[model samples]
Target: MTPTTGRRPLIGVSTYLEAGTRWGVWELPAALLPAGYPRLVQRAGGIAAMLPPDDPAHAAATVARLDGVVIAGGPDVDPSRYGAERDPRTGPPAEARDAWELALIEAALASGTPLLGICRGMQLLNVALGGTLVQHIDGHARTPGTFGHHTVKPVPGTRYEEAVPEETSVPTYHHQAVDRLGRGLLASAYATDGTVEAVELEDPGAGWVLGVQWHPEMGEDTRVMEALLLSARPAPLSPSGV
Candidate 1:
C-alpha cells in the first residue's frame, strides 16, 4: 500500500461536545475524542485534527481544508434524522451532534473528500444519504464498559475487501446497525448474524467513502486507516491543468 507522499496528509476527525466534563477540579463543556482516533491517524502517516461541533454553515468550508474526514463514533443518531420514529430502546437525541455531523458528511460527500465513519458515524452517514437504521440490536455489545469481537466478511471486489479482503475478526461495540442502505451505498461487509458491518459508495468516482460498523481505531489493524491516508493524497496535476 502507498503511504501519503511528500507531506503528511491532514486528517480531521469529528469529536464529542459534551455538556460537562470534569478534569482538574473543574467541570466544563468540552470537545473531546478518544485518544485512539488520533493515534490511529498518526500511525497511518497523517496529522490528526480534532473537529468539535461547530456551526453547520461552516462545515463545507471546514472540509475544504482537510485532506480527509473521519466522523468518530459516538452517541446514537437521533431517530428523527431519517424520518423514523424513536424506538423505545433508542438513546435520547443528541441533536447538536446529529446536525453538525450530518453537515460534515454532506460537505465531505460534496467535496469528494475521503471519509470514514465508525459506529455512530456510520449510522449518521446512512441518515445523510436518505437511509434508515436499526435502532437497537442484540449480542453486539454484550458486556458493558468493554469491547467485543466479531468476524467481518468482506464482499468480493469492494474497496473494503481490497483493504482487508478476508473474513477477519474486528473489535466491535455497537448496538445499532445499518438497516436500509443509503442511496448508492453498497453493503461492503457483513457479520455472521447478517448485520451490515460495512458500507461504501458504489461509485468509485465519489472518492473514498466507507463506513465501518466496528471501530478500526479501537483495534490493531492499520490497513483500513492506511487506505484512508492513501486516498487522502491529492491527485497529480496533468499537463493541461498545471
Candidate 2:
C-alpha cells in the first residue's frame, strides 16, 4: 500500500477492557467500546481500527500500516507508571490499559506516526515520555472539585488556536494532570485555573503529535479531530519488500 494512492488513512484507537465490574459484579464479563472514538476518526475522514489490549505484537504491526493513531480517552492511568502511589479517591487503577497504551506510544513514536491523545491518553503520553502526573488535582491545581471545567487560552499563533474557534469550551473529566512534562512536549493550552489543557511534541515544525486533556469526541468539538488528521502527512510507500 502507498500513501499517494489517496486511500483513506487507517487510524488506530485504543480500547478500555473492563474485565471486572468495579461497582457491581467484580467477576462480570469483559466489555470493550470505542467510546465515540471511531466517530471522531471518521469525522476526520480516516478508517478506524480498534487497537485492543490483546495481541499487542500484531497491534503494533497494524499500527505500522495506519497513517495515524488516535489514543482514545479511557480509564485513569496507574500513577505508578510515573513513580507515584495510587490515590484511593481516584478509584481503581488500570494496569492493563497503561501497558497497552505505553506499548502503542512506543511503536508510534519509533515509527514517527502522527498521533492524537485525549484525556487519559494524554496522561499516558506524558508518563511514557518520562514526564509525571499530579495524581490528584484537588490539592495540586487548586480546583473547586477534582474535575475542572474552564475556558483555555491557546498560545497565540499556535496550532491550538488555529485548529478551532479562538475560544472554545471542552469537557474536563480527569483528576490527574501533566506535572513534569515529557521530553519533546510543549504545553500548548491551559485552563484559567492554570491546569494544562493540551500539549504538543517539540519539533512539530517537523511533524504533528498532540495530547489534550479533554473529551472532544462527545460533541461540539469536531474541529479537534479535524486539526489532528490535517496534521498527518500522507505516509511513504512500503520500503522495498515489506
Candidate 3:
C-alpha cells in the first residue's frame, strides 16, 4: 500500500548487484535486495529507496537527500578493511560494495542522518569507525545460508533498551562478530555467549545511529524499524504552535 497523504520520510537502503543474472528476456548485472527491506520501511511509514552500489565519490551527495539510511545485510566485509588477514570462513570480498557502503556510512554519520546497520552492515560500520571484527565465530549460525532464532538482551537505560524494553527473539545468520567497540559507539545488546548483538552511538547527541548483528527486516518485530521512523519524523511545533 502507498501512503496517500503527508510526507513520508525518505529512507535509502543499500543494495548489491548480482552480476550476470538472467531473467525475463534480459541478461545483465542486477541490483538486488530482499523485498523485506523495502516492505519493512514502508510498513514503518517511510518511503523506501534502494541504493545500488556506486562511485564512492557520490556517497555524500546521495545521502544529502535522504532523511534516513539503512545498510542492509550482505556479503562479509573484506578483512583488509580492519587490517586483518582474511579468515577461511570469510566470504570472498565484494570490494566495490565495501567501498560504496563505507562511503555512505561516513556521509551519513557526518550529516547526522539517522542510520541503521544490519548484519554485515553492522560490521562495516565498525570498520568505518576504526574498530576490528572477530572474522569468524562458531554456533552463531545453525547452518550455511540459514538463519537461527536467538534471544538478545539489551543493555539497560540505552536507546536500544528503550526501543526493545524486553528480551526479544531475533533471526540471526552470521559468523562474524564485533571484536572491538567502534569510536563513539557502545554495545547496547548482547547474545547469551556475550557476542555483541547491537550497538548505538555512545553520545546521546550524536543523532540516531544503531547497528544490529541480526536481520530485523526478516523478523516480525517492528520496534526497531519504528524507532528509526521516530528519528526520521519532523520535530514538533513549539508551545506557541509555530
Candidate 4:
C-alpha cells in the first residue's frame, strides 16, 4: 500500500550488539531490537531503518539516501575515547557500533541531513567531531538527593528556544556528558546536575541537527521530538489559488 502523494522520510537508526550463550552448550546467539526509536519516529511520520555498525569507509553511500539519521541511546561509550577509565558496571562498547555511527555522522553533516542524538548518541557525536566528554557527572557538579532531572532554559536567540517551550522536564540516565562541544556545535540545553543536556550544530539557514542527553522518545515530553521531526520534513509547496 504505497501512498500517492508523499512518502515517509526514511530515518536510519543505529543498532547495538548484544550476545548471549547457553550455559552448557557452545551456541552463541545474538538479537537486535529497534531500540525503541523507530516507534518514536513513526509517531512523527517517518520510517525507521535499523542499521548495524558497519565500516565507515563503505557506509557513506548507504547513509546518503536517508532523510535523517538518529544515533540512539545505548551502553556507555568506550572510555578510551575520552581519556578516562571505564566503569565496571558499564558494558563494553560495540566497535562496529562506533564505526557505523561515525560514518552516519559524517554523511549527515556532509549532506546537511537532519540529525538527532540521544543519551550515549550525544556523547558519540561529540567525540566523532573532534570534541571531548566529561566521562562522569560527579566530576562536574555536586550531587543532591535527586538524580539528573529538570527542565532547561533554552538560549534566548537560538533555534531551539524558538522550537521548544520556555521550560520542560526530561528523564535523564547518563553519567557521561559533553565537556568540550564539537566544532560547529553549540550548547542548546543543560541539566540540573550542570551537565550538558543538549547540543546542536547551529546554522541560521539549514536543516535540523540537534542532540539531547535525555531520552524524549521514552519519556513524557513529545514536543521536543515533534519539533525535530517536523523541522526535517520538506516544506510543502504553496497551493495555487483557483
lDDT of 2 by residue, 61-143 (tens): 86678778878877767777888887776657777777878888888888888888998888889998999988777633325
**TM-score for each candidate, following the candidate numbering:** 0.95, 0.82, 0.93, 0.81
Better of 1 and 2 by lDDT: 1
Q: Which of the numbered candidates is closest to the native, going by highest TM-score?
A: 1
- Model 2, residue 131: distance off in Å is 0.6
lDDT, model 1, position 118: 90
Pairs clashing within candidate 4:
none
User: Which runs of model 2 end up more than 4 angstroms from their true locations?
Assistant: 1-5, 20-28, 139-149, 234-242
Q: Looking at model 1, which ten-residue stretch has the lowest summed lDDT?
A: 233-242
Q: lDDT tens string, model 4, 100-132?
A: 787788788787788888888888888877788
Q: After superposition, how far is residue 238 of candidate 1 from its true place, in Å?
A: 18
List, residue by residue over 76-152, the lDDT tens digit for candidate 1. 99888888889898888888888889999999999889999999988899989999999889888667768889999
Better of 1 and 2 by TM-score: 1
CA displacement after TM-score superposition, residue 192 of candidate 1 (Å): 0.5
